[model samples]
Target: MPHTKDELPDVLYSAAQVRALDASLIAAGTAGFELMQRAARATWRALVRQWPTANELSVLVGHGNNAGDGYLVAVLAQRAGWSVRVLAVGDPQRLQGDAASAHAEAVSEQVLIEPWTAQSGLRGIVLDALLGTGLSGDVRDPYVSAIAAINASGLPVAAVDIPSGLCADTGRILGDAVHADLTVTFIGLKVGLFTGDAADVTGELVFNDLQADPQLLNGTAFTARRLCIANLPRLVSRAPASHKGKFGHVLLIGGDRGYGGAILLSAQSALRSGAGMVSLSTRPEHVSPALSRIPEAMVLGTSSANQLMGLLEKVSVLVVGPGLGQAGWGRSLLSTAANAPLPQVWDADALNLLAGGQVDLPKGCVITPHPGEAARLLGVSTADVQSDRPAAAHALSKKYTAVVVLKGAGSLIAHPDGRLALCHQGHPAMATAGLGDVLAGLLGALLAQGMEPFDAACLAVWLHANAGEQQGKLGRGLAASDLIPAIRQLLEEQAPCLK
Candidate 1:
């Protein structure tokens, strides 16, 4: 069984992919029954370690291999002198292969097996073995009722494999899923466990590899990588004789009349993140205020696309849509930026405008969209984007021919070349507005500092989330501007420059 602290292998498989892997392993000489036994033993060990004092177990067994795992768990508990009762939701006679063997073993061990009932007195540590990862559509009948009863039982639940009803590929709950206190997943870690609603439902996750053949496991394809500090690109120091001109200039365009703060935030973050020269093209009314707020940035007042064109020549990176309103001025500025050949980072109104088919993206651009923005860009409903974020991100990347950063609970960074990474590190307090703008600026800074678009985005996401987490510890009302210094501090801490 793989422990939580163990380095996650490169391969991350979805439920369907893992099923195919299981079949391959079986075809390659491993018996199907033996694999099932390994799953049960791995689950049992995780259960005992998590709840050592629990002497009784209520196993909710369903119709498939998930039920087989539950039956084997019941037999193991019974042998250990722990009271075990299996509430079978499906007919035991219909069970086939390894599932039938498990049922037979449970029956022979004197483990009580009874049909699921509403008032089954399901006490003690509940083991949810109902649906597993194969479930699609809505959850049906007895399993739904059984899951509800288990939740209401006030007992800590250990879910075998995945919590029943979770889409192993998307992390979306199909109708309803078991709310496990700890889920012991076997064979491989499912992508669903880390994203979408799975984070809430699958608490205290534990992975068990079942001691599968290393060669087979290594050969499987991964869906996405889990983002962490360790996986982030290494930050490089400036050369001893390097000057300000050595780093690229970053041009930030946005901040319509009432939204000046958004662009200012982006520009400030870019400056803090190491852009050589940070410039802001915003509403004429806010120019003086923006300059006063961050004198290091050259704030320009622009009312037309022509004004923006003059500044584009010197910029290496362009960050658009911070506080960009959907007005004529915002649209004109966006059109101007879209025509530029420089690398770009698009956020907020830029994404909304793109969704409306008003502007074409520049080549080598990065679009940072929250779910709503992502949904708009993809021509799908927000529900669709949230339902399967990884797929949505990939779709966005492929459609725009740009690096896509789908921002939400489990933020995803997708490249056009089929590389996808998931960042599971931010806090709930990060649910504030303007943070996405800050991220765009950070990306621009990294680009200005000469990182490739993909690496710049990956590192920026980690740095932005780390800053949010650090500021979030200071309590609520974490203004977007507060993350600026924190990001600068974190970057220096991660990669300090010599004086």
Candidate 2:
């Protein structure tokens, strides 16, 4: 499994799509106020489950339905005999629709409500209900100060819907966002929660649909699909008569001078990931060590583009990157790969060379770029790419007309046809060198086996992330070579060769 989603849905939506789904539910005879109440109850249940011993609740409310949720949660807290108070950041009188009704209900329950000030104190578990998906621009005014106070309070915080000041579409933090210990979301999962800056602020995510009917959600459009076992690309089972030539051959080219280990890591990963015949083309000096490391692979000491001619003719797929520097050797090799019409996986120095405008990327290519390389390729700052990763991935795919794998905390795979998939499983300890090299090779092997470009990228990303997660449990000091064996085991578990 990519991620252990017990009951969490795979579909991810922009805030607008989720709102449209909510509207459709309302149109199908569910009242808007009733949905608000269900959301409040779900939040209340999650809050209590998160911190049952906390006998006090401090809820921050704004002028929208998010405030309605907070007000109703305050009612639940007060009736349960817990000390509860509402810090009305947005004036309660300005609340409209179901929010106004919730305010009246809180007033009737005698819940202590007061205007928020810089000096206001928050005790017990804090509920961030200041803003939901309605936020578009940066956070303003007293709300910023209120959010800072909540973060500084050092209490267990539960955010209703989403944290205030975080963009629901891009996951970009607007000014500042509440760092909640738990966040209980409603209806559908937002794309913001899985990518961009969401991982830094969203902790312990809990999804509640507010009990919306499945019939009402069938036809709703989604922004992206999360990769999981059910939807991952499947490898066909091997027959008893299967031979070495059954799977396609892969040619991996890299390793200029000082960087020899990166290409070997990739070659070993490709061999382990089931490439029929893995060929390594590297510096003449690396030949002995490469042969010693991975004897199962055919190691070639390639110093110039002429050295790769015969091998390139036989190989069906090429992985052109990883340790390939900006020198003439790397440039010549990458240029030759660019001219080949075969499927290719470009990564590391290959991506850098493409960004340098030296060579045009070939068709049937999958380019794996981290934020920095993506920014260089897109001619934007790294901050701009990270600010909206999904958009950057889409733009890169459209520009190069190749399947793009934007690698980061949450890796995105975007196709030229507008299909987007996301990989949400990864570990901080997996942030080591040569990991991208391994990913490039894994993607190459999948492509060599005849998976579609988008599907191969999605499956490779999921396997690489999950393997890193499995190995990262030992804490730090995780080496890049450690992922190869783990990836091999996971691939077997996911798509067994013997069926």
Candidate 3:
């Protein structure tokens, strides 16, 4: 949950965007080889800092410029009195331009170099320079065996730029990927490093701008911006004469016959996150428990679509579908809510129902969908959704004209306006149930308080993920309710009520 690269940049780039940034730097008078050498020096500095006691270096090189960085790291390691060896996974003779020059420099420095065999003895801290960002297909051949060996070695490892076999554009692992202990990435941070199967393989992340001019870094195009405290949307401080009615009222609809807890969690989160008033419309059986748990919220036992008509008119925001089953009663309520023209937050069964084409998603609302739910909505397999999450999020945003919160390790918030933001904050312990419900309600609360859909989602995701990270430190068995208090505290810290 600890963000190793939080000190880096808020901007995230696709593989091609970073390449263009690199090209612009070269075109601006910084020689390509000079940039490579700077990258090597940055990697060398990070390697020594990560494993100070290790004096041996075993570097794996591919045919790309990534290999060029690795070869240069070998030369720097040799000069620093470390035993260094380069395992040529990609033929050194195939190196071009700056990469070929890097190979020749390695040879001139008397660095020990050899072809990589399956039996190659990897010594010291292994440096994975095997593959670079251009990889578009599944891993192949000697590199596969090499990656397998690296994973099997159990030695401390560092990757130059990115871990070999990790798609810089998407976080998908191409067939296989190297698991590194420390990944020293140069220039810009790749969006792939935070999402999908990325967290499993990308260990400690470190970024170096390689001394690129600040103007150049700011001028390039990027895929998404990282959501952090500095860039998160803030709510206006309340006036001293402010009243509860001044803030918007929030209505959370869900909780079928047997699934009442999910909706309660959402309502509870909404109540605590500063909604002026919170309401719950659920089955008659849940009325007593809802009132007993959240006496602050107005709980109504709703059995038919007509029961929600009056309540829908009174609420300012709607949080739909937390445990909303697809039964006739639930469907009736959803159909009613769908036509209310309120700023809605759809999750869980609501998304499933939407995917079933039973109701159209309201424009400009927010839809929070996990990968499986996203696949259903997109009419594709979950694998397809995970393979390229950014694309899926973008597609959903465009299709529904809604603010889409694609929830996962690297949660993405995509706006209909083409603005995308990623939240890298979260804990592994947060993989439990009811979390999405909590997020949906929190987002609704933010919206009720007058934040725009995209702004509310970005802030809600950041707060929820950071709260999960904080509570997750207590270690496993993190309940969905555990995040509510933490989120309230974080919201106060982010945007104080008085000031």
Candidate 4:
């Protein structure tokens, strides 16, 4: 059956961890074949639920337990009077153990089986049970051709365990991975299913533990926690006599000559997201517009580091680099903010300047970088950062000694000590400009309000993405400012004021 986001398990595991979990279950009395059969049953159930009218199925089977599951699914389809055929990519003669038994069961059930070939015609809904988690390198030969054909086919496809050719550990596409409309993963939710290229390949994800032992499942260690509103760090409510000063002030620095909008968005977002007092330090020319746009913000126009130092004395948190250019004016302001002892959130040009070695990341700060900026910070190509985001995030966190929020499709929040969290919600509309500026401001607001760096980053990310998701439903043209009010409402709902 189709599962809701909240219904899926929170803990994500590596391929090896999942295999160990499987082994633990097998060693504790459940036969490996029995587990395979359960997986097939679960996949069959989910497939039927997703497309009940698609009576005909073309099952692509390979070797290993994933293929065994496919063969059994074919058997179930045949027995249920649905037109079904199994195209074995791996030699049926080479099938071993439980997989061999499963193939024999399909044969005994009179299921049609044929060898996979480039010329082979595919009909009905395709089942991509090829190349399980065991595959480590790039997809080679006939399998690559088959995957290409399956993708070339417009037919709806369901992948077993994980999508073929998609790395179950890193979510990197090995050569080319099968883009499944529905992926039925079992035992544990693989980390790859939610990050990197997983979003491009894994369409509707369905997870079934196959009734794994709760004691064993709970005991299994996870690579990272998937951040959701239900599991997010909670914020305490305010007292009845509380004043604006109780929430703490957030000072946002950056708005060079032509980039006033970036800093304005950040300041407005900080105010809306619960910062007690939000201050904007920008170019002198921007003072009137800044106040006109966000009257609640305390606008301070300063082009020099000395002027910024005075403002720094009164703020609790610093959010730098929204419209911060690498020019002399931006550099001076950033230089002053960098030496401040306050907690900080750095983004955009601040990251660029940090990458250029002009300034060092302050301790107890949160740095938000998209792939491009991350590449600069890490001294690698953007492809390298995208290829393995978790590693990049961890490296950045350790290198800077700050919480790192690697913002992308599956946004990852990494702590300096190695703990990591991934945000699974974000909309295409969030790809607009000024969003990162808004995110930096939100991060600063959370930090000023007394959330830990890592916790603030995680909660801020969830709020930013979820608000984008909410506002994005209106369809396209989602402004960065459009997210602020929605975020304010959602934040209050998540961490209510009267509690």
Candidate 5:
């Protein structure tokens, strides 16, 4: 949470794990009350910085330590000459230990405390302290109504720790969740904050350790590591005399009529992302356009599975599924690629074809599937996939014995051995068409360049997402091709070609 020298805090903790950490710190001589006070102080600092001009504050208090944080924040604001009110949704008498102490401190400070009602005056910036990570079921009664009211109040809400009603372990919204304008988290980073519905509800995320001992956290196991530029895998510098043969050739197969652009985008992306050579095998009708679009790539028009055999043998990596129709031709190509020993990247209709149980995915390949494709492959609904994306990603990786890229708001790259990486980058503009095709190609290029399957997937996903983030600032109508140039530039910056 707090930046410690020489340590990049990338571990993501679950709700239960954070509690274990709290207990660990407490057992190690730090009092629970001390941690509570620290959490409150961190929240106060963040709230004041965000709403410095607001002279009034409304703190929604529940029965947990989350509410205790709200109470202490109210005390801080009241002492700072800001008018503060505490709306106690859960009875203050129900609070125990540190939370009760916090409530008593607020009362001593004469912070205006009142029972929450449906018509409670919702004024000033709202502090959502109604729920905590302990919640496991759907929110019921007063809390649900309060969360709904807070959402409708149009007030800038600052959620303490995490937004109420959001699953801390899975990032799923239970019934509903408070849409906070800002959320200040403590102890360790919760995996929920960056994935699934949490991304929509959690505004700007702020973290603090309450300054807990860094060594204590090292002993704890994390749910997943949040992928950032600092911890991302990087490619080593290439020699000046490096030639085309040094980097592996990537053969892209797909583009059944009307989907020619998909394969072209993949081929072009592979070429631009440092693949030594790129080959496109598609319908005969798409040959001219593929050649015209990316003159650097060898365009081959293949009609049957046999034609793909030679191409498959010549390439080090194979990218399948970009605009690959579910017809016989696409099936034939996918079938051929499935048998090849080359490293593979599969997306689009290829995922659908795999879901249909027609083709076997090759070992040590990478499969990128959005939630919809993931659900079909897992024989579940999209809602089920979204409910627990990390689990879904791990499931896919083990099921296929390949690296799995679960593409969505927060893309997850999962290895068959249970290692998982979450990419919290990318922009809304990247929700356009043909991006997955580009990603598959880029991933293939990395694999072809001799990066391991998991490392290549992680690097490619980060590069793809970061490129979209940079290009998305231009606003809207972002085509898939716009990302290729940006990705090329970013790759040079992230993984320089020179020593």
Candidate 6:
């Protein structure tokens, strides 16, 4: 697992797993109150580091351990001579065990505890310690009003652990959620913090392990591992005397009448990313332009399934669907590829075609789909797919018995064996058209070079996102073609070929 200064644990845990960890800590001779205090002290240190000069604090306390963490943070702030106030949103009388002790500590420290009111003039850095990971339904009552007030304040907020009203299991926002400027999470990272709306809501993420037992963590199950360059499999170093035949061939099947650029981008990406031989089977009208754009690729003008048979036999890997239309020509070509014994990468229109039941997917293939395409594949609405992207990706992989890449904010790659990985390195600029094609081609190139479908998909997503991040720094006007050269540079930088 790769750990950056600003990144959380690569191993993501669900709400239940996190609770079990917390319970295990208590069972391992550490008192629950002591653990709560440690969380508070950690949050306090983060708060002071983030805003050293701010002397005012407004802590929003709910009824759980999350609220206990906030109360202790308020006490720490008050003891340090800072003006700290706690708005107890939940009934303080109901707080039990660690939470009850934390409340007493706050009172003993002379921190002002007040009830949440509509007219409360919330100033200073607000601490959103309201709902946490255990919430299942819509936020009710004064808590809703308090959440609304916090959003309207326009003040920077520091969320303790997970943000309130955001599902820690899925990235779904339950009715309403706090949009924090910085969220400090403890123990293991949660999957919700990196995908869907969580990406937008969780501004700058900071993680604190709280000195938990590494042996205990190693023994537990994780939801997914975060994708990074360190985790990707590299192509084997080629010998100096190696020929073109040694690198394997990739056949790109796509490009309808007016969509030649899509297939051209995929071929270019594959060629640049170290595929030994690249071929394109597209509409007759696209062949000339594709050849003109990338002379390295063996462009074929094929309009029927019969024309694709010869090309299919020569290639080791197939990357289908970039700009494949829903016309009979596209269907014929796809049908032929479906029967090929080679490893395959399916993306864009190919996914759309599969969703429409045009053809069955080849075994040991990879399917990359955005939320809409994912919905089509699962026979559900787009909302259902986005609501639980990890579940959707896993379902797609199992249903097709192939690797599935669910592309969105935090792109997820899932395998049929119940293994999953996520890439949270991309920028918003990567949401442009033809980017998916570039990714498919990159994955195809990896597969041709002898990587398994799951490993290739994970590596391709990380490399593509890293390239997008590099170009994203230059601002807008980033084209899909811009990522190819960037990806080539990144691949060499991360995993140099020692020929």
TM per model? 0.94, 0.98, 0.99, 0.98, 0.98, 0.98
Query: In candidate 5, what residue range of length 10 has the lowest lDDT sum?
Result: 1-10
| Candidate number of the best TM-score | 3
The segments of candidate 6 whose C-alpha lies over 4 angstroms from its true place after superposition are 1-7
Error of 1 at 258 (Å): 1.5
**Model 6 per-residue lDDT tens digits across residues 222-282:** 8999876556777778788878897789999999888888988999999999999999998
- As for candidate 2, its clashing pairs are none
Model 4 scores a C-alpha lDDT of 0.90
Q: After superposition, how far is residue 455 of candidate 5 from its true place, in Å?
A: 0.6
For model 2, residues 1-499, the per-residue Cα lDDT tens digits are 1223446788899999999999998998889999999999999998888787889999999999999999999999999999999999998889999999999999999999999998889999999999999798899988988999999999988899998988888888988999987889999999888888887888888999988888777788899998887889888888989887978899999999999999999999999999888999999999999999999999999978998888888999999989999999999999999988899999999999999998999987999999999999999999999999899999999999999999997789999999999888888899889899999999999988889899899999999999998899898999988999999999999989995
Model 2 root-mean-square deviation: 1.4
After superposing candidate 1 on the true structure, give the runs of residues whose Cα lies further than 4 Å from its correct spot: 1-7, 493-499
Off by over 4 Å in 3: none
Q: Model 6 residue 224 lDDT?
A: 94
lDDT against the true structure, each candidate: 0.87, 0.91, 0.93, 0.90, 0.90, 0.88
| Model 4 regions more than 4 Å off | 1-4
lDDT of 1: 0.87
How many clashes in each candidate?
Answer: 0, 0, 0, 0, 0, 0
Query: What does candidate 1's lDDT look like per residue over 394-455, in tens digits?
Result: 99999999999888776889999999987766666777988988999999999988899988
Q: Which ten residues in a row have the lowest lDDT in candidate 3?
A: 1-10
**Model 3 C-alpha lDDT versus the unseen true structure:** 0.93
Better of 1 and 4 by lDDT: 4
